[model samples]
Target: MLSLGVRQLDDILGGGVEEGSSVAFVGSIEYDNVILMHQAVLEALKAGKRVLVVDFRQPPSTLLKELRNHGIDYEPFLDDSLTILDGYSNLYGQGIQGGRNVLPNPLDLGITTAIIREALQGDEYDILVIDDVTSQYTLQSSPKIYIKAVVRLVNSVKSLGKTTFVAVCSDVFEKSDLAAILIPFDYVVEVSKGVVEVKRSLQPLRVVEPKFAYMRTRNGISPMKEHYQSLEGLKAQLRAGENGTIWLKDLRVQILEEVTERSLIETVYDFLGPEKGKELLYTWGKKQFIGYGEYSKRHNTSIEEALEDIFKFTIASGGGKLELVELSDSVIIIRGTNLFPSGKGYPYPFHPNYAGSLAQFLTEFTGERWEGEETKCEAMGAEHCEFVLRKVR
Candidate 1:
C-alpha cells in the first residue's frame, strides 16, 4: 500500500491505496485536482518510488516548471525515477522538444491505450497517474470510447501490480454517465467546493461524516480538521487583540522539565526562597489563567468552562486527580489526590510553588485577588490534598 502523505485522508482511504487498485478523483472546477495529483506525485517520489504521470492539462515542460515553482526539485528524478507522458503537446500537433515520452495522439483512445500498456509492460512504475482523464473526451465522438480506454488502461496497470489514479471533472459528464464510468474503479472520491467526500470505496466499511476540507500549505495539501480551523480563527482574534487555546501538557512539560533541572518543589524553594517562590508561582499561574480568559471571552464561554478544560488537561497529563468541589462568583475550591508532594521528611506538606501557581490562576480567572491555602495535606500524613481559594478583599 502507498501512503497518501495526509494522515487523516490516509485513514479514510483504508490505510492508503493498495497496489493494483483503481482510484478516481472526481473534482469540480472549484477544486484543484492538479494540486492534489502534484502532492501525490511528490509523496511518491519522496518514498523513492518510480512514478509515471500522464499530463493532459499542460505540456510536460509546463508541468515541470509548475512543479519547480511549487518548490519541487524535479531535476534529480527526471527520466530516471520520474517519467512524464506528454499528452498536451501532441493534441496540438506540436513536436515534443523536452525529454518526455510523447503520447503521439492523446485524443485517440487506441493509441493512448497502447502507449500506456507498453510503458507499464516492464512493471517499472509503482504508481501511474492520469491527470484530468476527462480531457481525453474533448474531441472524441463518444464518451463511451474514452471511458472504455480509461478502464482498459487502469486494468492494464492493475495487472502489472501498479496503483492508478484517474482524475476527472465532476461536472464534465452527465451524472448517470459519470457513475457508469466510475463504477469499475475500486474507489471514487469527489472534491467539490472545499469538501472531499468518499462517494465509493471498497474498504473502510463505515464512512466518516463531515467530509474533510482540503487545506494547502507550503509543504503540500492535507485534510484540515475543525480544531485546526478553530485554532486559525483564534489566532486571527489574538492578532486583533484577542486570545486562544494552548497545549497544556506541552506547556507543563516545558516548565517542569525543560525550564529547570531541579524538581518543581526544590526549584521553587532554592531559586526564589519559599516566600518569594510562592508569589512567583502564583504570578505564573495568573498568566496562564489570563491567557485562558482571553480564549473564553472570544469563544463566548464562561471562565468556569475554561477552568474545566484546564482541570481535564491537568489530569490527562498525569498531574494528579483533581476535582472541582465548589465554584462560585467569589470563591473556588478544588481537592486533589496524589498531588506531587516532596518525599522523605521534607519541610513542606505539598509543592509550595504549585499552590502559588493555582492561587494566581484563580485570581486572574476570577478577576480578583485570591488567597490559596492547602488546608489538608498528604505529606503531613493526611489522606489526600485539598486546596481552598478565598477571595481576598
Candidate 2:
C-alpha cells in the first residue's frame, strides 16, 4: 500500500523510508548494504524529496546510474534534487585529505561526513544518503568518534524531518559495536546479494513493525517471485529410498543439542499442503569450540572427513509428510545450510541448532534447563535420553 518507489522493496518495507533514520547495511552479507542505501535515495527522490548522497566509496552519479539498472529511476536526480560528493577521502592510511588538500595525516576526521554536512548546510534536503559507514570506521579514530558522527548527522537531519540512510557494512566484524549504532535506528533495511529484508529497529510510530526472518531469492537473488508457488505448494524428500528425490519446496529443518520430541520437531506443519514437513535432525555435541582436530578426536572421526557416515538416524511419517526424521541421543550433527553433513544418528549439534542458539543469543531468549532436557548429566554410553531445555520461545 505504501511506496518506497522500489516496487517490491517498498512492499517488503511497508511504505516509504521513515523521515530521519540510519539503516546500517552489514557488508559481510552477500547482499551489500550500501546498494540498499542507493535504492533508498532513489526512493526519496521519487517521493519528491531532495537527497544528498555522500559517497566515500564512489561518485553518486556512477552509483545513481547503477541504481537505474537495478530498478530505481534516477531521471529525477539528474533533474537536480540529488547531490553526490565525489572523492571526498584522501585518508588512505597515512594521509588525511579535506576539501582543499591533504593534511599532515593523523586521520582524525571522516571526510565523508564533513562533505555531507557541508552539502546539507546549503540545501533544505528531505533525505540524506551516506554511501557507507565502513570507510569512516576504518579510517576514523575510535568508536566514540563514529557514534558522535552518526548521532550528529542523524539528529541534524531528523530535526528537519528529513530521512537519512547510512550504509555501513563492515559492522558485522564487530557485532557489539554495531549494536550501538544500528540499534538506535528507527527502521533498518538490509540488502544481501539479491535479497532485500527489512526490520523495524527502533519504531517511533509503533503501528506495525517487521521482525527478522529468512529471505530467499527467486527471480534473481534473495527474493522469490511474488506469484511463485506458496510454501505449502511444494513436496520434499528427506530419505533416499522409494522417494528418490522428495520435493521439499518448503522444507524447514531444525536442530538441537539433543534431539527430543519437542526440539526435534516442535510442531507438525499441515501435510495436506504440497510441501508439508521436511525436517533435518542433529545433536548438540559440545558447547565449547575446540579446534577441528581436537573436536574430531573427541568424536572418533577425522577432523577433515567427517559426516553422516558416523551418525544414527530414523524416519517416520507425520502429518502425511514423508521425511520426518529425528536424531535421538546424539550431538554435533550438521543441518541447515549444509555447513556440515547433518542428519539422524549424528554425534554433534547441527547447523540449525547453532543458528537457533545464535538467534537465542541475539534475542536473549529465556533461560531454561536446556542441558537437563535430554540428560541428567552426560550419560556414559547410555541410551534413550530425554531432557528439558529452558527456552525464550
Give the per-residue lDDT digits (tens) of candidate 2, residues 1-393.
214434445433544545555555555544446545555565567767787666665444566566655666666565388665544344443354454322223234555456456556755566677666665666555766676677777776666556677776753437766766765566766655444556554433222223222333221222333222233212222323343443233443433343354343333223322122222221233232214223323222221122221121111222111111232332222222212222354333223333333223222211221222222111222232222333232
Report every candidate's CA lDDT. 0.66, 0.44
| Model 1: CA > 4 A from native | 68-73, 93-100, 205-207, 226-393
TM-score, every prediction: 0.59, 0.47
Clashing pairs in 1: none
